[model samples]
Target: MSKIQAKDVNGVRVLILNRPEKRNAIDLEMYTQLTEYLIQGNSDNDIRAFMIQGQADCFTAGNDLTDFLKHTDIDPQHPAFRFLFTLLDITKPIVAAVAGAAVGIGTTLLLHCDLVYADKSAKFQLPFVHLALVPEAASSLLLAQTVGPKKAAELLLLGDSFDAETANKLNLINDILPSDSLFDFALDQATKLASLPPQALQASRRLMRGNIDGIRLQMHAELEEFSTRLKSDEAKTRFHAFLNKKSHKPT
Candidate 1:
């Protein structure tokens, strides 16, 4: 079965992350699938908006470390980077419903979303620093811009997990909803966007996002350092430790 599944409701394209076994940890194939779906959805006139969600217990555990470690190159055209870049260029509005864990790019991806709703069970974290790495998805720039440098520093530097309430307080999410109703609520919002005037909505969204060029530059800067750090001894050691921890976990 496909790790990423898509369904159309009215004019909204709903993308479901379906790797519950892996806690929906995105791999290279999943990234490619996501990029293709988003690009296809944006161009299809029948699809006006998008909604991204995962299983009741997880939004995503972040990337698949085994798969990520296998890739020595981290260029702009890399599948993971392509997915992030696709998020930046998508014209249609994207809404996200997050529950359980949203780690690393899982949380950063929310920054590019137009609306985000999380359940009380949701947990957000940026553990790049903990892994001896820098931020990606232009999160270093956007997070600082959204919540100010001080709070951004607190979250990124400490690399700690935070709850849904804190995410709402930081304006990272629109609001927290009951876990049972979270998916329906987020889908409703996306459907509402699909019901609006597409041109006007797209124009308003673009105006609000301001300079795309600046965001692109920030992503490039982050990727350059991210690639370098991926090669470092500290990062390699942490990666090995993480793999070991996972291997020893009681199932």
Candidate 2:
């Protein structure tokens, strides 16, 4: 079965991260596939909106550490960067349904979504600092804009996991729901968006977002810093330590 699954429901194109065995951790191929699906959905007139979700137990554990460690050539054209840019460029309304762990990019990517629903059990974290790297997905700027600079610093610098209540309070998520109903609620919200007048919806969305050029600039800046940090000796040490720890864990 495909690690990333795409289907249309109620005019909403649903993209599911399907690698449950890996906690839906994204790899290069998954990033490529996701970007392609988003591009296809954005161009398809019949698809009015998009919804992203994972299995009931996990939204995503973030990037697959093994895959990330193997990819040394980080650049603007990298698949991960491509995915981030594609997500940022997508014009249609995007909704995210999050449950369980949403680590690293999993949490940051929600900033690009129009609406985000999380289960009460959902855990969100930005562990770039823990990995001895920096934030990506324009999160350094955007998170500060969303939750003020002090809180953003705490989140990024501390690299601690937070619960859904904290996420909602930080404005990262629209609401928190029961774990069993999170996906359905998010999909329903997406369907509602799909049913709205397209031009007006898109126009309002664009207006609400405001200053795309600024966001693009911030993203590029973040990418540059992130790429540089990824190559640092500290990051290499942390990555090796993390991988070794994972390898020794009981299955």
Highest TM-score scorer: 1
Residue-by-residue lDDT tens digits, candidate 1, 16-87: 999999999999999999999999999999999999999999999998989979995999999999999999
Model 1 ranges off by over 4 Å: none
- Give each model's whole-structure lDDT: 0.96, 0.93
RMSD of each: 0.6, 0.8
Task: TM-score each candidate.
Answer: 0.99, 0.98
Candidate 2 TM-score versus the reference:
0.98
The clash count of every prediction, one per candidate, is 0, 0
